[model samples]
Target: MALCDIGLIGLGTMGSALSLNIAEKGFDIAVWNRRTKVTHAFKAEAGELADKIIATETYEELIAALKSPRAIILMVPAGGPVDDQIAQLRPLLDPEDMIIDAGNANFHNTRTRAASGEPFIGIGVSGGEDGARHGPSIMGGGPKESWDSVAHILEAISAKYEGQPCATWMGPDGAGHFVKAVHNGIEYADMQMIAEVYGIMRDGMGMDAAAIGGVFEAWNKGPLQSYLIEISGEVAKAIDPKTGGAMLDAIVDAAGQKGTGRWTAIEAQHLAAPVPAIEAAVAARNLSSRRDARALGEELFGAAPKHLPHETLSIDTLEQALIAGKILCYAQGFVMLSAASEEFQWSLPLPAIAEVWREGCIIRSAMLNDMSEALTEDPERNLMFAPYFSDHLKKNHGALRQVVAQAALHGLAAPALLSGLSYFDTMRTARGTANMIQGQRDFFGRHSFVHIDGSEGQHGPWAD
Candidate 1:
């Protein structure tokens, strides 16, 4: 049997989508899942191309079907299950056999896993359900030779967003997962920012879901246009089917996280980098999950502070705030990614990464295209100094500040958006209060000052 170039071990949403991509590309695909029914489900769902995908009943059969020196892609859940699957495969496969873990496994775990006897690559995939079905942003970190062997297939399957391939090599040994972890950390912040927009629009500005959705649709046509905003519009318009209502009962208020976002925050803490927006987003999700605490707080503290009843907010104004908040959220995310790249020595191409996210990924945006262009032209260019971003922040920081103040006045939590904006403001403002301490240190510790003598290095007294 010709060695099967593609084998997928999971048939979940991501795995299935990837399998389709592979099969569509004319690669012979052998798919197996731990749960037998998932394979059956895949068979049922996969029309016409079903015969090309062989469902395996046993691990040995699956391995045998792939032939020698097999290249298998594991799209299973991260952590222990991945370990277990690898253990089973190691004994059955040869040294040249390759495995790619495409799930969002922890980078530390991925590094440790790669250190095992068998050769494997940790790949991080983004662009959630839709990205899976169509294409997704793929990041891989492993042996250069291993990456080379699979690069062609990876590119074929990955989603092309913003005129760049969604798949890229993020250097060796866990870098891909690390970058993806940061991607997800940014994703959390982005989601929270959208939620804040909704809250402010509904509770503060009194815009209906359709109106909010309409604003988002228009925002999609501009520089702030993005996949997230487009989806937000659809979600805003989604109504409860049963009750003929605007509320979606299918989605619970309690959001359960898969721990990657928390891991990103934890990693940031370890790196001695501030990820306030991401951290705040994670905290907000946790707070949402803690229903008992919320109820208790309400009971113990009595009625919450009141804001003006929902009033109609202009679509134009809402769109502007959305744009500003989106920029801030991305800015913070990129900063965190930059910090991580520096700390981990990944040497990631920021602009290239941004380009991939512009099309197929959930966070795909016109802003990312600009980001991609800026960073591609100069890899070392920090986003804070990017001309477009700087100009946008300069023009809209005032509006963001006002929105944040108004949200706070109404007791709405907008930590991600607000923190990101604050970060941007701090980065840009030359004489802002944020750097007062640094200036004070220059005056006291370094004895460097804007001197009255009008010379290069003149002194200024701190106690004066």
Candidate 2:
């Protein structure tokens, strides 16, 4: 077998797709799997790309098949499995050879591994199985030199937007995974907000799946144009083959998660950064899992969702409200990213991060193009404060407030949308309720509050 450009472990869906993509990009890649049969099957089914793949059954053969000072990618499950693989590879691998964890890992583990004086990097790859086979957005971290050695291949395999690859170096240590967590957090909020609107259309407006899908399709042609929106349209448009009814109606209401969004929420709280929309989305998922509890509540409360008449709210207004919610949600995500950057001293490029998310990633949207431009002008400022987005908020916020009010009046659970509106309102306020909160805290806990009159420490008047 020819000496391969890279060695990949774990011949699972993502690993197989990525290996084929590498071979398609004209790089010779060596591959292995925990199950030897999987490696053999992958090679047998590789078709023409098999010519560029050297499938090995063992770690030693995989290493031997790669070129000197080799680079190996681990596509195994995150956490313990990654550690076990690295431990297995350490004795056979040279000091200069790199171990890249291309899984959705918690960034703290990445930081520990990166700082271990080893040739290790943790990266975040998005776009799922199809994207891995074609192109996905790649976020790389660890040493610049380690990244540079693999940049050519990563860039070639990344999705492109306007001729630019959606792959980039996102600072050192766990920066890439941290950014990926935030990406997932934003994705959760985006999907939640979209689902919230879909609820409004279905339950409130009494629209069927096809009509709701049509709405999503129309939205895709405008600022809401995105992979999620486009797919939402397709999902809604799908017909159930068995009963010939709406596909969405046939499916269960529960949404499943793998915890990246939760990780983002936890990390944000750790940094004392506000990401209310993402947090609300995470909460929504948790709430959705309790089908029994919801049914019980409906039985106990004697209140079901009442329809919102179209005379009071239009689909156009709902679209505008979704637009505003998306803006607020993203602004919160970016601010959380800024907080992480400051706390970790990663110097994460917020503009470049936006550009990287412009294609391939789930959150890729037409709005991100404008966000990239805006963040380029001032990366530190809130995205809503950007000239383009600020104008958008100005025009759409009233629609958002209206939608939120309507959802409340009727019995719809639009937590993400409501959270987005609350965040937007809080951000625009000058001198707000935090002072009252501080005073209450001081009266109870004696934590002390900064006086408005420039006194260093102050206490609330508790009838003392």
Candidate number of the best TM-score? 2
Off by over 4 Å in 2: 461-464
**Which window of 10 residues has the lowest lDDT sum in candidate 1?**
304-313
Q: Which structure among the candidates has the greatest lDDT?
A: 2
As a TM-score, model 1 comes out at: 0.88
Cα lDDT tens digits for candidate 2, 1-464: 56999999998889999999999999999999999999999999999988999989889999999998899999998899999999999899999999999999999999999988889888899999988999899999899899999999999999999889999999899999999999999999999999999998898889999999999999999988999999999999999999899999999888999999999999999999999999999999999999999989989997667898757889889999999999999999999999999999999999999999998888998999899899899999999999999999999999999999999999888999999999998888999999989988888888888888889677777826
lDDT per residue as tens, model 1, 44-109: 788987766888878787888886668888988898989888889888887789889989899999
Model 1 lDDT at residue 105: 95
- Candidate 1 C-alpha RMSD relative to the actual structure: 4.2
Poorly placed runs, candidate 1 (over 4 Å): 1-3, 162-164, 249-251, 299-315, 429-464
lDDT value, residue 277 of candidate 1: 81
